[model samples]
Target: MIQLQSSAMQDTQLVSNMMYFYSNSARSSNGRQSWILLLPDLITQSRQQTRVAVLATSMLLLAIQSREERIFVESLGYYCQALISIRRQLPLVTDPQNPDFLPLTCVAIVLSFFEALCGTLFNGYYQHVQGAVVLLQIQGPRNCALVPYHSLFYAVRNHAICASLMTGKISPLAGEPWLTIPFSLSKKSSSDLVNDILLAMPRYLSALNADETASETSRMSREDIVQDLMNHLQNLAGIWSQISQHEHPIAESTQPTIPQSVELTQRYTYDNPYHAKVIANYRTAHLLAFSLLSIILPCHDWDVAPFLDDSASILSAAGYLEECDIGCAYFQMVFPLRLVAQHSPCATRRRVAIDMLKRWCGEKPVRGLANSALEAIYRGQCVIPQSPVYRNVYPDMSTEHSKACCERPVPKPFSYTAKGQWIKLDGMDTYITGDTKAQRAVLWVYDIFGFSSQILRGADILAHSSKEPILVIIPDWFRGSTAELSWVPPVTEEQQQKLGTFIQTKASAAIVVPHVRTFAKCVKAVYPRIQRLGIFGFCWGGKLVSLACQGDALFDVAAQTSPARVDPEEAKHVTVPMALLVSGDEDAGLVARYAENIRAETHVEMFPSQIHGWMSARGDLNRLVVWNEYQRGYQVIVQFFDKYL
Candidate 1:
């Protein structure tokens, strides 16, 4: 234990001693524990060292221990390492590709699982696969003890996927109430959750694919992948729910969440030492089942490009990157099939599919689409009867007034148009159109809510600003899945490319600002004589707008809320104006810091609260409402546009 800093300590002696200790420990190895005890505790050690060393140590230690010990230690190491990496610095964890954050080791818990089981008549709930992994590091040790917490997190976040939620996947009414019974995972529960979720997903995808197919191929459509995925999700959900919750369903009425005889299997049989190994097997299954379900359920419900994109956003929030990647691949795979479904006109199945997607994406169509299937509920043509939102301070306010919509005759906003169709910068069909509308045009953005779609609470800046001859830059993939997109087969790569390309074409709506340098070109092209313009965006689009404005002359005014990315240096570069809108309850501290950085460097409007979907839409979870109470963001947007745009 000599000090490591001294030059004289170029210590072969230390290495020799460590090796001796390692070898001796093998003689009476407590397995992983003995090895760990002999070494510098990796958990407490500083992380200037490479991660391979940590993985290597854990792998070898696990090899020496009992199955139970090995599994637990392995999980512990992965979780610890994941936490460590997040705490240390790296680029912010907004993008999935960030290296400081991909924690495959923690994902070890979900490697294998037997996702088949009878319901114990109970229930379920997973977040950010990228930055969330880091946030979970800051989440501290609450759920880090073993596999259960990760399993719980995975299940909770992916509750829809786990149960195979059918909303937005089938006819919206297919599972309107989700169940005939009051299904609860606890005494407070009762539901046919498993069945409803599984059934709704494929039904919707089938409808989507069927709608897109030509009259000839409509009759010849092949395998039902939506049903297949739902079955898989149901199987996994039932099995893991049974095991984790300790219940088995012998009755048809009982839709158990875990597996039958599960706890015993995981606990011990007194049946044999092999019981422990069996426990490891079950633990592995439990973890995998939950993780996969988290990913698959949301995907199962929404195959439309907008919904798929939304699924990605939800996955990022739930911290299911591995699942997100898998979901993205699946989306690519089945894309073609769904496209065919979407091609069909006014078929009952297609209608069902659209409804299901609406539920999942929290999309309640404001206006009816042109398709006959949606004719019954079409609100697009008719002025939708504004639903009254209940609140504490104000008398119940209608959603119409609650949203701070930008004023009509929105002063000319800065406009930029792109030459080609919207090209996907990162899986979005983004188009920007702005030309000397305001001294500087300000843009409003959202993740899943596109300009043409229903409004999200107070986020009607685009629609409400009908008076303003503003150039509206609408990105194609804002919602990930939309009514138009649902009809496309999202399972095929060719289809994905085609659809992605089509969406990208929308960029022709405005000047294509592909790179930071080209952005200035867009500004120059649009505002050769103008002096100011503002840029605004939401969700993924919000992130994009924020990034695009970084140190560029294209945007004179900018407002990004619920943004996915932030570049602080952009503050110094931004010459004109900017603002950030955030509301509801979720924390925007990280983004707020960026805002502060901007304020430190320049003046910008900023909303320090959480507005779910920027009050652009509603968020539904197992029927519980989170952001159904407000719609003032629209008003805020309107005011911002008035002041800056």
Candidate 2:
């Protein structure tokens, strides 16, 4: 029995060495050194059972990143046994006066890391974070020493804040006694200052979330708290900027360093990965602060230009970090990067953010946080029922019903004329109307109905009304799958299912946005005379127009009539002038909120007498009131283009 115990102890020591080496080398060298160096002492001083638990947890983490599947499964089994043992000892560890309390606290942190590495659900990580919080509270600030515990405190604090932001739940750690822990700024690095700002974010967000439920007096107080936090973050950012500037002068930093040959597997050998991480973290802090401020302030009241500029800076830093193999060094960056992806409104920047998440997932697949971040991106891109047009059209319907409406076809009342030629552009059949020689162009993105006579006629009306000769190009963004106009609504369960499937597969913003971008580029290249371009879409197409207006300057003006799937979050990125024409029967409040959120000049016209799909429905053309509204709405579009384009 003594010899067996000795052999097991030898194995544990070997595993500890391997885990520490991996943590320092594979994860991060500089940032993780303190934690890695203290692990041995932490393990030695721990109770026998607690020591076994910590070692098992550490080995489990290493096994997760290991290339061997059998090793991973065996480690998981051992960790499970350790967890059972730890659970039985929880009562003793929970006591603040117990000798094993701090050791157990450190072990809980390692367990939280296990949860993080496995990419357990958001709640899973939060539970472990709460466990750590309890331990830290028991340890208290007076007993908390700065060296070994500092890194753990910061790590737990950051995890709590990030999980809170991602899940929209206030972290338990963000509250009173925890926040009172002194984070000394004097000896702190720039990264620490940025973390301080991040640690305060959950409190700010929690206040903002609570303001809606609070009484007027309480609301004002919460708003004041939010504003103060914002100011504090701004000051921290300023201090970080000064420190970084002094530490990394422009001349010295800008001078190109000689590129060293690095193997793909040995990329982490580079020296400046930490420097790049610091820079990225600093920029991300500013991005988060500005983003929160934008959320708190009214859309028209705040200038998004700073947010835009900061997003660009973060993207640049992310690129450098990627090259340095430190892209996934900080999990805290995932939340900020997710925000950038969701809110930037610039398609290029959003794509970069998404790609960064993808790259991070590739690099750190064991850390399932990137997968959650990707899901957030997917959610942002997917059409939801909260859109103004969607809510108005299907006020009582579920998200599935709103999606069904996009696939339901509108009638084609008129005939395709010779003036409007069907030509193939970029290997896709396109319906072209208006003057081909015009200096100005309007890309009329049609809804799920594809190219119909009614839509082409509307294009002709727009071209005729333009102050300058305008070439209206209608690209079949839907390829050829367009629903035929029907006098009766399709009510069959099978039909509804088909429509829903079609919307999910074909009519998604993800699928349509990229095609629209490609089609816009093709149209511009086809007609070099088109110096100014405007984009207009109806219903499903309106969502595409909104996306087109997001970041690319290809379109000078954008107009959406009865636009569906215009995510309010994505809508805030619009910088170009916009015109929103809606039927009076639609959700006026939703539209008004959307109009208010747009940053550029916006004109919202409501034809209260008209119904949804009046602009594109040939059946609606017969109704005098609907026809008049369509004419008026078209006139609004022409005037908007004339003014802006």
Best by lDDT: 2
Candidate 1: which stretches are off by over 4 Å?
1-438, 443-446, 455-470, 475-520, 551-554, 563-577, 588-594, 600-611, 614-632
What would the per-residue lDDT of candidate 2 be over residues 1-645, giving only the tens digit for each residue? 112157457556644654554343233333444344455676666666556656655555555545556655765665676677777887666566787766676667666655655654455556767777777777675454355566667656656666666776556565545554545422555665566666666555555655466766324454686577578766866766654542231232343231221111111112355555555566666665655665555343555455556565556545544454331354556766676666554545666677777766765532567776775455332211121211223232211123334333455466546367778998888877779999888888776666665687788888777888888888777677865444124455345445555565677878888888887888889898888888888877887788778876878888988767445566688888889887654566666767788889999988777666677753357667767877888888889898988
The most accurate candidate by TM-score is: 2
Model 2, global lDDT:
0.62
Q: Write the per-residue lDDT of candidate 1 for residues 542-602, one digit (tens) a residue.
A: 5556556656456666665544434444445455556666543323444445566664233
Once model 1 is optimally superposed onto the true structure by TM-score, how far is the C-alpha of residue 480 displaced, in angstroms? Answer: 11
lDDT of 2 at 180: 48
Q: Would you list the clashing residue pairs of candidate 2? A: 584-608
In order, the Cα lDDT scores of the candidates are: 0.33, 0.62
